[model samples]
Target: MSNSLRLVIGEGLEHLEAHRAGAFAGDPEAIHQARVALRRLRSALKLFRRHLNPSARDGFNDALRALGRTLGAARDWDVFVLETVPAVMAVIPDQAEALGALVAPAQHERELGHVAVRALLEAPQTDAMLQDLGSWSGDRVAFSPRKAARQLIADEAGPLLDRLAKSVSKRATGLEEQDDEERHGLRKALKSLRYGIEMLESLHGRGNTKPYRQALSVLQEDLGRLNDAIAAVELVHRLPDQPGRLVIEAWANERRQEALIELPAAWHQFKAIPAFW
Candidate 1:
């Protein structure tokens, strides 16, 4: 079990490093993938927390979270400029010129965000942190050598996945009435559940996991549309006051209403899917 934990953590590190160059170059997909790697690593640690040394685990979690924040800042602007703005532009063709002008400020902010990403990548602490984590994953001190550490991952994955699934359902109980913060909480829970399923997919086999994964994907997409609206308002407000900003706020409100109307059906569909694990 200890060896299994090391393998999983090592694979996460490898994934994180693989996208380093692309993320450094400010590629949107790479930045997203890099952020995902950080998330998977953090999820893996929490999934197998009982088997790890608390002090070392806390240190690694803190470092990974800091890196995640840096990547996330850049990713938010990427989604704004690349996805949200273009989406609005498509619907309001008459405002294309106004929307196009808005892109410059968002892009500038994005570039500044990427500058922070680059700085973090170049910082000595980043390398040291990764190296330390990589080493710790294999170190005897990192593993508690408890009974749980000796159990097979397959035996444990099902319960771990169940907990994550329940977390999403619990947060989603009053979905329609949830405030932005609560809805945001549900989104986070959904992501964790999805990641948990992905991490354990090999254990369950693709045939068994496919239906649940698909349902999860659809539910996530619905919630994401709603989230994009909420996020769009924040991004637009950060820009100077202008007509384009007003246009975006109105567009965002429309998107939010549409998403809210569609959310219940999507949630119900997701709820009906049987647990694959």
Candidate 2:
């Protein structure tokens, strides 16, 4: 367990360094990979929290959360401009100018967001906090690593899996009437549950966690598509009144309705997966 934590933190740190260097270049993959590394490290901290000193664990978690926010904001714009705009454009070929109008300001937003994230990464405490986390990767006095490897799957992982499963099952009802806030809430909840499952990946060699993860991925994709559509609608709502705005609204709504059609079955498949912990 200690070795695995060390490796995971090391991998995340390497990616963080890469992202920090390339942030101003506005590379989408750098933004995406860095956020992913932060998530993986956060997931690790959550899993092995019982093995960390309270101050040590809390400090790292809080710092990572703050860093993730700026990076997340930047990535959202990147997705909207680079990825989502093209799809909307394809849908309304005649309104290509309309889609570009939306994409332009978002691209500018991405540039501004990238600056904010770059400044955050260069903050004074940022380096010290990352150093502390790396040291934590090596610190194992709270629990014996070998003993944790033997018992953690049942004692720690199983209960979280059970709780998240119930939460998803409960929140997933009445999706058809759900507002934007409610749908976004579901997307975040499902992502948390999926990340929690991923934290226990090392323990799954003797079990069937892969299929369980696969089911969650499908559900996540469905929720994500819905979110992109909603974001499109919101962007169109923000644009200056023009004839093209109506066409863009119609295009986004079509995509959203299709996702609403697909969500229930995906949610059901996720709930039916046998718990793997």
Residue-by-residue lDDT tens digits, candidate 2, 1-277: 5666676677778778877667646678888888887887786776566666667777789899988888988888888777777876776688888667676666778788888877887787888888878877866653444555445444656766667667676677687788878878788777767766755554454366778889889988988888888776676665567666677678778888898899889978877878876
lDDT of 1 by residue, 22-82 (tens): 9999999999999999999998888777789998899899999999999998999999999
Candidate 1's error at 35, in angstroms? 0.8
Please, what is the whole-model Cα lDDT of each candidate in the order they appear? 0.87, 0.74
Against the true structure, whose TM-score is highest? 1
Where's the lowest-lDDT run of ten residues in candidate 1?
199-208
Please give me the total number of clashing residue pairs in predicted model 1: 0
- Give the clash count for model 2: 0
